[model samples]
Target: MYSSRNMCLKWLLLLLIAVAGGAVAAASSAVRRDGGVTYDRRSLIIAGRRKLLFSGSIHYPRSTPDMWTSLIAKAKEGGLNTIDTYVFWNVHEPQPGQYDFSGRADIVRFIKEIQAQGLYTILRIGPFIQAEWTYGGLPFWLREVPGIVFRTDNEPYKFYMQNFTTKIVDLMKSEKLFASQGGPIVLSQIENEYQNVEKAFNEAGARYVLWAAKMAVGLNTGVPWVMCKQDDAPDPVINACNGRSCAETFVGPNSPNKPAIWTENWTHLYDLYGNATRIYKPEYIAYQVALFIAKLNGSFINYYMYHGGTNFGRTTSAFTLTSYYDPAPLDEYGLINEPLWGHLRELHAAVQNCSDTLLYGQQTNYSLGPLQRAYVYSGDERKCAAFLVNADRNNTDIKFQNRTYRLPAESISILPDCNIVSFNTAKVAAKCTERIRVPTMKFDSPMLWQEWREVIPVFDSTTLRSNLLLEQMNTTKDTSDYLWYTAEYEVPADAKAEIKIGSRGHVLRAYINGRLVGSAHGYFRNFSFTLDTTVLFHRGVNTISLLSIMVGMPDSGAYLESRAAGLVNVNVLGNQGSKNLTDKYPWGYQVGLVGERVQIYSMNGSSKVPWSKYTISPNQLTWYKAIFDAPGGSDPVAINLNSMRKGQVWINGQGIGRYWISFPKPDGMPSQTWLHIPRSFLKPRGNMLVLFEEEMGNPLGISIGTVYLKKLCNRYNSYPFLGFSSTRRS
Candidate 1:
């Protein structure tokens, strides 16, 4: 038997040991409260360690929800650690007080998907996202708001801005989406490239930026907030660089305490209507990346677009085509655009391998000669990395630290270790480039198109009268794009008459006595024109009707509200006398085509409507409907609209988009005629394609086709995910 004192002593010792073990376990399991996301002047600290983050922009609304996972996964496989996207205000709240977050607008689902893939997210909540979206991502209804001025220090604008921003923040907080709440979102962005046009707004713009920064900070989301392209961004709000190459030198008026982050590294330029596609070489992009990492000591870099998807509906602006195919790593169809994708993957890996050294090491740069330079990053005694760059057009041999490196023209050599070259921008690995081809298909059954005439309303006594020509936007309030102008004139026997009209409308069609006459449109802006047409008229009252159509609203300008459309003045000149009919005579007005009011786009909806088998020539307003079998398979379908003139298309009652082939070709835009159809929207049979041709072209040539892949080049490139491979360059 042990003594009582000895027993007590043994118990005390055991208790001390248990407490010590508990303390050790607690220390091992403790996690950082900020979800391990922090930043300093050098780099972003993730999981309590400094890291070099490579992010890519993939807008949620541009793609389907079903596509979010695959797109994000592909981005990950391509060596991206983060995904970025813009939150479209117009898409969420198309009408004030009414909100939508379902379908393609489900931004929360998109962020969750990114998180599920173990990736970070950067939410760009730009209420004024000028991503070629209609009205610059601002609700058209905002124009209707009383005493409202956008993107400035206006009280009404700020009130709505705060409301929307608060709603988003509250929703994000409730879902615990911020990094501080153990979610995937590590950063938030407010305002886009406002600095570009800030000078126009002047002092108000400066005040608005400060207010925006303060508002963003007040949201209390435990993640860093950024203001892209805003040079005057206040402290606590990081100012990010956006452009082709946002290297360290490009860091604008940003606070010195924040890490240098490139918000948008443009991989390719956005396509404009009537312009040919702009292609960015993969080799050059790789060189830019290597230079950014080596020369600029870049911490975090995000590609503007990893996947540039379709711009469905009326979302296209700046005269851009419906296809938002921005020649990115992933094509518009979501397939890997190889050589570019693989090459970038290799470059990402090379950078990631030296992430520690790049983030924490002391960087030293040396200029060997003109356009030839070397960068060395020394983390410690044993860990070091270097980059040998030759930016000249000719190949050069660079001697660095007793080693001669053959640098190719405008290329970069990445040495993960200071000793050997892991990858070179000039030495491309073999990879298959995907070329999209539209395959010809023979329909099992011939497509039959039913035609209908859009009845033009005649003037009646009930027609509203206005003395002065009214602006279309103010008069119709965007109710419709079409407007009618009518007047009466007495035509004397054998009298020659001409109608002189001054207008700012997009397209103008004049008709005398319900008969189609000549049509005229301004080359650029609205101008004065005289229409002379021979017509047999009695010595009594004659009817004159003119139709004006607007392509789209002006999205950018000062005092945009003052811009006017439609006939500003009208006069009739005859041998007998001249009449100023500006607002002297009663004018008849109509909002839209008859087919729009009747729902003629749908087969079931238009079953009661009479149809004609005969098709009309291009120029007159007409509706054409065709039924055909769906182009089967997983590949996306597109209708070649090259045969058709300017118009709008509907697929099974869903509006595809507006097409205007009549617009004059710009320098870079090619004559585009293909319109993409989402695979999810297609059915096996009884698929209908309805077109409301405003200005005509042949409808008989319209056909449906699937995009087929063709190998552009056979460049063998090794990816970390695909393992190492040795192959010859194409």
Candidate 2:
């Protein structure tokens, strides 16, 4: 492994390369500053004056429409003036030329709701957004487009990209959603994080960026355009920063005319499956924001997820948890995270109060020792603001303005009046609370089971032999996660043979002559593993059938768009004879599971399914359904999947997400036992709950539950008022 010093040096070299590249992109044109939304090096000028912006991201699809109003209101009350979101292309344009802007995919309505709440918006329209979404928010059908290449300067790719972007802009224009139209959206983004893989595309990547910038400019949306993480972003497109702390390394904007802005300061990493939940302390995150304002003069700061909602349906990419970001200030259910939420709200108000001075004031800096410094902003009429920082690990006192003040370790003190410490990153004065759960089976029922509409490959008598193993994504078009392939092995004499199937898998289950042989799944996305099990082979035409399942597809890397997702190869090893089956086909394949083809996940479509009332033992590749009434009242709801092994869940035809209760925890239990069920997806009666179990698990143990928080204590009330109460957010 490279040492920390080497890593730092590597980053320095990369930075130098980026700066040199930025200079080249700057030659085309300069950002047009004469507009309704302009920027100086220090601030974003809005309404004809420099303004400080506190923004938060709330992906509309992550939450239900019933939850949008409350979520937006919560963000606004948290002292945020702006809401940031990415338009999910896959969700919007499910099929070619078909649009779905209704329901949760409604970007216009989401924006109008932001406008209704008196907040601005930053709409990142990446037709190729890498938001840990399926296909990185790109429409899966685009892969089926003739002569198409995604995210680079391919003509075919550009056409659809421009088409979708123009569609969104036109829709917003029709609704008057741009700032130029006196709407909420003040900024627009095109293409996301292209620079990370630009090197792989070589010169074509560079050219593509230029074309994208020019195309975005041609749109004439009347708001500033942004290209996030693009150091070489073309002229007129403000290149922005995205990381944990912009202050640590942000040099400035790509050009002098553009204000340095942070597009996505991640609140915390999302839950990667199989890993325990991780957290970034409230004070720790606050310090990053405070340091950005104190040292970098960053006027616009947006949290990637101030409130991370659920990753409903099959939208989650790879093995990510259904709970998108559990460490966010707001939980997946949209409730406050207590101390963290409260602390940041306090920080927001403190910073907002000093906005005017920080925007127009003359800046001065002072160093009081190693990592101990002070920044003072002097504005009109002697009004001033200050930021006292202690970046060291130990508490220290510093004398500033001829007065001594104590600063905690790795903390920053924000003084809106320049003389008093109103907010400190190390302080958490909000009342503390702990969550309580009635996560019991409020409603439980014996579910009816059924065999798939079509026979499993092992049972098919008319199976044709094939040598070719098809790639998974290309065959399914991401419409379904399951693919079935059957291959024949001829054993001249009766013998014990080993059937080996190597797969580019999220999951793979193998069956030899109607007998369950073995199944294996990769813990990570696109993991390569083999399912090898020994079986007695009959002399004539023994059938080997394999089922490949994609838990989630790849969402990153330069060539993820073309990554294979199914059985790569298979072989039979026996003393009688050995042969490779992968070379045998003209492989025609089954598109997906019969249940999916029959649309069993939807209410109307499920009635057509043939169900058996007789109870069956827990088995692989099975379907089960139960009808139950919704829990009474409006509190948030969750379902306990502890009884089941692995499968996806759907309620009233709305998919919650896939669940794997078998992945062993330290206590030999599943990592996540209870999963969220949005209240909006629930109805008062006859809620249909469907499960497609891929492994042996008892469905009878499933139950309904409720999760709520109980206030524990308060300690800061007796202290003098340093800032407004952060709990006033509700």
- Full-model lDDT for every candidate: 0.73, 0.78
lDDT of 1: 0.73
lDDT tens per residue, model 1, 1-730: 4468755754454344335444322322343444645566676666667768899999887887777888999999999999998889888997898999999999899999999999999888876777767667777787778998888888988999889988888888999998878898888888788888777776667667777877776777777678888765666667788977655347543555577778888878776544545556677677767777776667778987899887776676535666675468887767787777888899889888988888888988888768788888999767989888887777888888898888887778889898888889877684666556564543223247677877765566326567667677676666566787766667656565767777685668787777776677654333334454544444778777788776555555444445577888777777777788886567777766678777788767678579777444443688887777776667767887776777788888877877877664665333467777777666888888888887676787777788866666665343212111222111
lDDT at position 512, candidate 1: 77
The TM-scores of all predictions, comma-separated, are 0.87, 0.90
RMSD of each: 12.4, 6.3
In candidate 1, what residue range of length 10 has the lowest lDDT sum? Answer: 721-730
Tell me the spans in candidate 2 whose CA falls farther than 4 Å from its real position.
Answer: 1-35, 440-454, 459-466, 585-588, 614-616, 664-669, 713-730
Model 2, span 403-514: residue lDDT tens: 8889887788998987889999988888766665575453334443343323576424424334477788987788888878876666677899887888888788777777
What TM-score would you give candidate 1 relative to the actual structure? Answer: 0.87
**Clash counts for all predictions:** 17, 4
Give me the runs in candidate 1 sitting further than 4 Å from their true place.
Answer: 1-32, 248-253, 430-434, 438-447, 461-465, 476-480, 494-505, 520-542, 557-564, 571-580, 583-585, 616-619, 664-670, 714-730
Clashing pairs in 2: 467-582, 467-584, 467-585, 468-585
